[model samples]
Target: MATFATSDQLLVIIDPAARQTDGESVRIAKDVLSAGAAAKLCLPEGPEEFARALDRRGSRRPVVIGDGRALVRAVTLLHRQRELAGCALSVVPVGDTALAESLGVPGGAVAAARAVLDGAERRLDLLVDDSDGVVLGALGIPPAPGRAVAARPVPIASGRPWYRSLVRTLASRPARLPAVPSPCAARLRVEVDGRTVVDLDQPVVTVSVTPGTDGVASVEVRPLSVGAEATPLLASGRSVTVTGADFRYRADAAVSGPVRRRTWRVAEGAWGLVLPAGR
Candidate 1:
């Protein structure tokens, strides 16, 4: 909804990750977009150039061609500049497009490019943190950052390091670490809309926050059970807060924080995306 009316002018930003991951797909997307509209392509080598290209987009609508992280990168920049509410983004997911797919974008280059040229604007909700970070998809605790390994420290009754636990990696796939703090579970206080759902006294297993379709964030906190398996504490609210020991979390596909406290609030219908008209 950035522009009052749809125009043929388009700003196509092809991400470097897409080129590196799948060059053939990128080429196909480029061919389709250029043939459909009056497009100005920006092939940025890095993040800075990418931000610059999008920031300088005048009246032309932005069409991002890349993976989930690239899409998040675009949204994050627009949100930071307070332009997300006004701009409607068109996405062509090239590699690992789980986030883009969840938001209703048609997968693959041809389908997505077609959507960009002939589609309707669909507005959606998002979560923004105190530090101005945004989460477009589901967020998970016990953060998994890289393609390698991850370790998060948990405080035990006695001050000592927890034993290291590793998962085996096969082929070119990366090993996924255990999500919870094993042996010594992490103690965290989770609050949903000012009400404390899980306090620091109890050790936590994991937590997740996802933007619900009903304009609120769905929160789930799994705590360590003493006798029986503990049912995950669930709540829905416009705001959520977590405090206690420092913890890292995965927002969309990125890792964030070693912070003691963080708060996230829902911004309902905050951004718009162009999707297939019938979809």
Candidate 2:
């Protein structure tokens, strides 16, 4: 159960990197969105500045102005801003719009801003890790002979022809490991609601969970050695816990946790966000 409030208050946070690279586009988004609602632009200088901007967000609807990373930052901040539950979140998706697209946000700045004006909030699932950090979307882990794609900030708009022309591109090749002595494979002990599901000394490329009525269920798991194929992990239960040493994982597009262990709990319909019509 979540509450909803109708208002035009909003706070816009732009990633400084994105601002520096494409100031004009970001400016257009800001101006367009601001025209419709009371909005302020807060460009984060770095992670600290990012966190501080969120801390100062108050109770306004938050509009993120970067790529997937920007949206993840907004989600994490909103999760922390538990008081602002049910607030609208508008994203002027700038960088890799794939993740945001999957979430139903239009890629174009004007269209995204239009969504803010016309869209209604829908409930979306969020992951809460053991260390109390939050991830909005997918998480990736690298496998042996294949490094975790999360290790390097995969350039946001790598493959998109339009975006590639617009922003710097990341590696063209999929994540692969070093030719030298293969790095130690990641070993994770995963459990759902206290029951062991996977425990192995093998290489895992990625793990994801989506929220459901009963709990959080495993959405997908990919192994680096398996090429591009991904196996779907059954979704069931309210809690998931992962323990490992030197584990590198990506929650959504934001990277965190080289920590030994992490736990995630279903926040129970924590976030209500905009989705495409059918979703």
- Indicate the worst ten consecutive residues by lDDT in candidate 1: 162-171
How does model 1 score by TM-score?
Answer: 0.83
Give me the overall lDDT of model 1: 0.86
For all candidates in order, the CA lDDT equals 0.86, 0.68
Q: Which regions in candidate 2 have their CA more than 4 angstroms from the true location?
A: 1-7, 47-59, 84-86, 143-185, 201-206, 210-215, 219-235, 275-279
- For candidate 2, the per-residue lDDT at 233 reads 52
| Local accuracy of candidate 1 as per-residue lDDT tens digits, 1-279 | 322233478999999999999999999988988888888999999999999999999989999999999999999999999899889898999999899999889888899888888888888899999999999989888674346365654433333333222221122366565576433367889999999999999998788999865689999988888888889899999999999788988899888889999999999998888988865
Q: Write the per-residue lDDT of candidate 2 for residues 35-117, one digit (tens) a residue.
A: 88777778778878887887777777777888887777767776776743656566778867877887778888888877765
Screening candidate 2 with a backbone cut-off below 3 angstroms (N, C-alpha, C), the clashing residue pairs are 122-273, 130-263, 138-252, 141-205, 142-148, 145-177, 146-177, 215-237, 217-235, 217-236
Worst 10 residues of 2 by lDDT: 141-150
